[model samples]
Target: MTSHRRPSSPRLGLAALACGAGLALGGCHAERIVADSYPTTVAQRHPIVLAEGSTRLDLPVGAGAQGLTSRQKEDVRAFAADWRKNGRGPIGMMAPAGAFGATAVRSALASAGVPATQIVSQRYTPAGPEEIGLVKLGYVKLKAQVSHACGLWPDDLGSGGGDLYGATENREYWNFGCANQQNLAAQVADPEDIARPRAEAPIYAARRQTIIEKHREGGDTTTGYRQADAVVSDVAKE
Candidate 1:
């Protein structure tokens, strides 16, 4: 028996419902919760998506297939910026000796605010005549990337083959949460913050001592009520 099936977008469905119910203003928020069931969703992954590691850019010869094209120049700048954001240590740039745009690539790296001293240059030689030349980019950083592959609709949704919950309630498939999780991973600036939080701000010891003294005499600890843009005490006294 042939079964006709139309793919369902959980996000779009929630958006339509929100609009019909006159909740168009807060509709975007409602849409966000529709697919977030990895921990809160029906379908989940084993290792989860947040556990991340190093990512590398095996720089392809996309620009002109010569030294470095404008596109390649931009790529170097972007790569350096990303490296400075999280990854530390010396950055490496490998280019074939006779490549067309090596100077342009070096200039781009400098433009990206990377100190030339921090970069270690290496001569790249092709393995064979047929092999295309490429400038490799790599760095170690705490990357919050997806651990699983998406678009994994194992059984046909229409036929109602596998688990009964999906067919009866029309729930999402296993890979439903992967894309949103991947997006969340990509948006994060500091991935190490996920593993451990940053140190807290320093405390005001003088203020604490003053508050303690006030409390001993049964006085209110709250004292200062300065407005924003207030002048310094020395300037105000003058």
Candidate 2:
């Protein structure tokens, strides 16, 4: 009657146990998650144009009103000249919209060896809701997508998308206002008014790279770029 019970089931090693558990969990496999990012470097460069400062121009701030002093007029002319020479064509007029437009203009003038002067303040009514809405949509649709395409996620603080609603709204508002100014300037005078001395003024395209780079360094560059790129790529893919 020396019957020994069958040896207890062999104990599984940690590895074997893990494998069994994994199998039991429906054999899930790790899949690469793409947040659809954009190029941070390019996005950042877009706003760099403002870093240069304001350029003094010799032009009058008003139309035959003579509101500006002689010195002020000279400063305006100097700035206008430099803007015509080095600024990005008609687009340069949009400088007032950007954060560093004044600074960049000053820097450009100085670089061109022009003297500096005080700038006259020209205030206008705020943008209407329709304009504001369009701008907001542009940011939400374009810039935000760009950020996300660069492999960025709203949750990632490094991506700078944490407060995307606010940032995008602000950017859109500013850009819209700037664009509106350009439109008004264009309408105020003939083509000559916005004309530049140089045949080839700078273009916004050059700043594209700068925008992307700055954004990359400032946040989750990889994610933002990836997300943005993916979004665009998908549209193209479709």
Candidate 3:
């Protein structure tokens, strides 16, 4: 018995060659096409930035008011506390020239636990008649903010300006997720949280001891609720 070997078809060989050439051409075209595909992620496009900025509070003074009002005192206290936490330079207090609230502002800051040496008192000419009695307090502090400006439309979202193929690539536009990034930056309490995590807080030693003792005695280790009604549940109870 003689074995017959089948010859390869020329048409099949030519078809394979054409297919490979087509793929190669497609890849070259893909590389040559100029697509603005940088900053693939929204975070990369609009990153959060930490920078030195000023925090300000304005307290209005009435004609006959002797000192800061109750509301003004609260605002000043909060401002002082925030300054102690994040501020680096001295806290600045600017009051209108000949304003009666100048002394009150200093007293309020001192009452809020701010050192008298750390407060810098200054007087400024009022911009207008309405601002004659306004007291401005501020401090320089590090703040977290978005790097890019929001509400910008550099590129057309629609298939215009020779970007039809780019639109079809399913890539995000230039201003995508900008508002979200800004919101995230604004919501961050500390600017350092963006750079790195903070040190772990100390554990509750008393709570840990209680749990451990309960576990050793084979008693319930879970937290006991004195008022059962405080717990929220949708299931029907017996």
Which prediction has the highest lDDT against the true structure? 3
Question: Mind giving the per-residue lDDT tens digits that candidate 1 earns over 1-238?
Answer: 9999999899989968867766545433432333323342633452334553564555556334545556767777778878888775677667665665555666677888978787777877778766766666566566766666767766576676753545555666676667777777678777665457799999999999998999999998987687867569968799
| Global local distance difference test of model 1 | 0.66
At residue 123, candidate 3 shows an lDDT of 79
User: For residues 1-238, could you state the per-residue lDDT of candidate 3 as single tens digits?
Assistant: 9999999899988967877887887732333445546677988889898988999998887434579878999999999899989997998887777777778888889999899999888877766776447787888999889876898887775647644545677777778899999888889988899999999999999999999999999999998678655434544452
Candidate 2: worst-modelled 10 consecutive residues by lDDT? 135-144
**TM-score (all chains, Cα) for each model:** 0.47, 0.20, 0.71
For model 1, the run of ten residues with the poorest summed lDDT: 31-40
Sort every candidate by TM-score, greatest first.
3, 1, 2
Candidate 3 weakest ten by summed lDDT: 27-36
lDDT per residue (tens digit) for residues 69-181 in model 2: 45644555555554545443222222222223344444544554544442323323325423321100000000101111222233444567654543544433212233334
In model 1, residue pairs whose N, Cα or C atoms come closer than 3 Å (at least 3 residues apart or on different chains), thus clashing, are: 37-40, 37-41, 67-100, 67-101, 68-101
Error of 1 at 202 (Å): 4.0
Q: Rate the local accuracy (lDDT) of all candidates.
A: 0.66, 0.38, 0.82
